[model samples]
Target: MSAPLGVIVAVRGEAEAAVVAEVDAHPRLTVVRRCADLAEAVAVARAGLGAVVVLSAQPHLDADAVAAIRAAGAGIVGVGGGPGSRLEALGIAVARSALAEAVLAAVSGPAPEFVAPPERGTAAMVAVWGSGGAPGRTTVAVNLAAEAALAGHRTILVDLDTYGASVATALGLADEAPGIAAAARAAARGEDAGALLDRHALEVAPRLRVLTGLTRAARWPEVTAPGLERLWPALRAAADVVVLDLAAPADAGASPQGPGPRRDGATLAGLAEADVVIAVGGAEPHQLVRLVHVLLDHDGPTPVVAVNRIRAAVAGPRPEDAIAAALGRHAGVTEVWPLPWDLRACDAAARDGRTLAEAAPRSPLRRAIASMAEVVVAAARAARDAPATVTD
Candidate 1:
């Protein structure tokens, strides 16, 4: 007779032995190995030693690890409940007697199909990120969203600066208290994020909506993946363009445990889902130096660079040329958008709680920002027209 299907069990304590016994009892399914831990199981699976693996719902078996294990060519099924969707098909109260059937089903059953509707609109995300030292990221984000709206595209601007959010203050919406933190909290509680999202996002200008940031920095923990993940997609569905003002710590890959959430987790999460990333930095020597590093560190799609607040006083007569040369040499940047030093106009808009489109339409700074917004809108539209390359 043919040998039974190979199964590796990675469950904890007595449950591990019980699973092995349960699987071995079946004539079609057999235990090939019983791993001491998740690491051993992953290593073994990576080596092509087994056909199926029953994993623990412990902290070690995360989403990335599961993807890695699957890449190694082993079929993975969850043995218990976990934080992520590692083994979503299996039930929490899965019977030991049914373990063999579940394994067989995972190996032989029809793969779960994920299909997108033909009518779903493609909403593009333009993420505005700047390294440490305020480099007008909020200004760029707000204007870009506003300008896109002026260009007749539905746009949503979000403040994701966990360190300190300036979008609300700059737009004089601090009194309204509309922001993502409360929406995130509501989303985490399993409420309809779409409804909460619309409620939190206020229309600062026609065709332009703004989702303010946290009132207090300490409340950032509420911005969990469950909520932001839901809210962002919903915003995209409602608007043609979504602009996010990101902070310096956009790549805090550190996986923190328990109560103290990673302060910049929301930024990282948002970037992961963004279609375009606009790395903004000042033209000053210090800001440029950090900007080069930040640009090089980004690992997503080719990013657009904006040398914000470029002026002769700080960066010499050819500030734009100098910034471009430095970025090209160090960070291999070929193109850059120069935002002229028009502090007075920007300050006026902030003071008036209005966007440049409304406050200073004739300003050179506004013109440059409008140009950048045009580029963003065109790119986002092009991306939308192209075949959807993303896989869930």
Candidate 2:
């Protein structure tokens, strides 16, 4: 004879007694345990005491519990629920009257087996960084995000600058409570991993959303790696591309003795996770010097440089060619994208709270940014497809 089906009952209110009786009366089903709550039911399943949990559909029977039940290697027949309940996805939703048949049938079949979800590639993380003195990291990040979106990719502009985020101001988004800072704080407190994308992401354009940064500079420490560790996966899952606007690189060059100097947790995390890094720098000599030093100092991935605000006055004649030559010779950088000065377009967008693509698509600066987005996308794809290098 076939082995009796090991079942457990976890229900409340009127459905409780009926479910227990039904399982008890069924010849093929055996009451392995009657759990007081979902936690105990999950525990019982984890301990191999129950192979099936007859769970009640109540307000407290949340998706998390059902998932726990499934993850614990137990199939569940949800009772006391109707057509539009959360437990319907479990594929065993039943009313109190149908509880006996549902439980017996679910248990009669082979026990639920854990199946790994199929893997799908997400949009690569692109870090837009700048050396200090306002190299326009926000401008680069926001435009790149918008451009990526315009290129038919879902993108999110994340302002990770703990010291005064400008994405909201740049996009004219409402300064609200659910900004990155708030999400970071909540994630630090161990909230759902997807909360970062589900609750905080704000749509600025058709395919672009922006996660505004910390409103107060004092909350810089709140954007920790631990919080972002839980957030990046969710963000990647939500968007096809993520353009992280990082603050000026500053890790104090921690020596080799210890864990080294602590960099901004978010910046460190972003750099670590990024598949492409775009280093935006000013066109002037001082900014160029700083950029050179920063690239060398940063012990992270190599970056493509974008010389922003290039003008005849600052960069001399043949500005684009000149800057490219300088960085290539001095910094050994071959890929240099020189963006022309367009103060009028930038100012207009800032004032109107719109991206350049939306406010002034015809502007040279906007066009340059769009071209750069294409380059970044190509680089990301190349990096993703490249064979992993083996080392001795």
Total backbone collisions for each predicted model: 0, 1
- Go through the candidates in order and give each one's C-alpha lDDT: 0.76, 0.76
Q: Who wins the TM-score comparison?
A: 1
| TM-scores, all models, native as reference | 0.70, 0.67
**Cα RMSD for predicted model 2:** 9.7
Task: Encode model 1's per-residue lDDT on 84-130: one tens digit a residue.
Answer: 33343122223334778778876775433211122335788888986
Q: Which residue pairs come into collision in candidate 2?
A: 254-261
| True lDDT of residue 178, candidate 2 | 64
Give the distance in Å from residue 342's predicted Cα in candidate 2 to where it truly belongs. 0.8
Cα lDDT over the full model 2: 0.76
Return the lDDT, model 2, position 216: 76
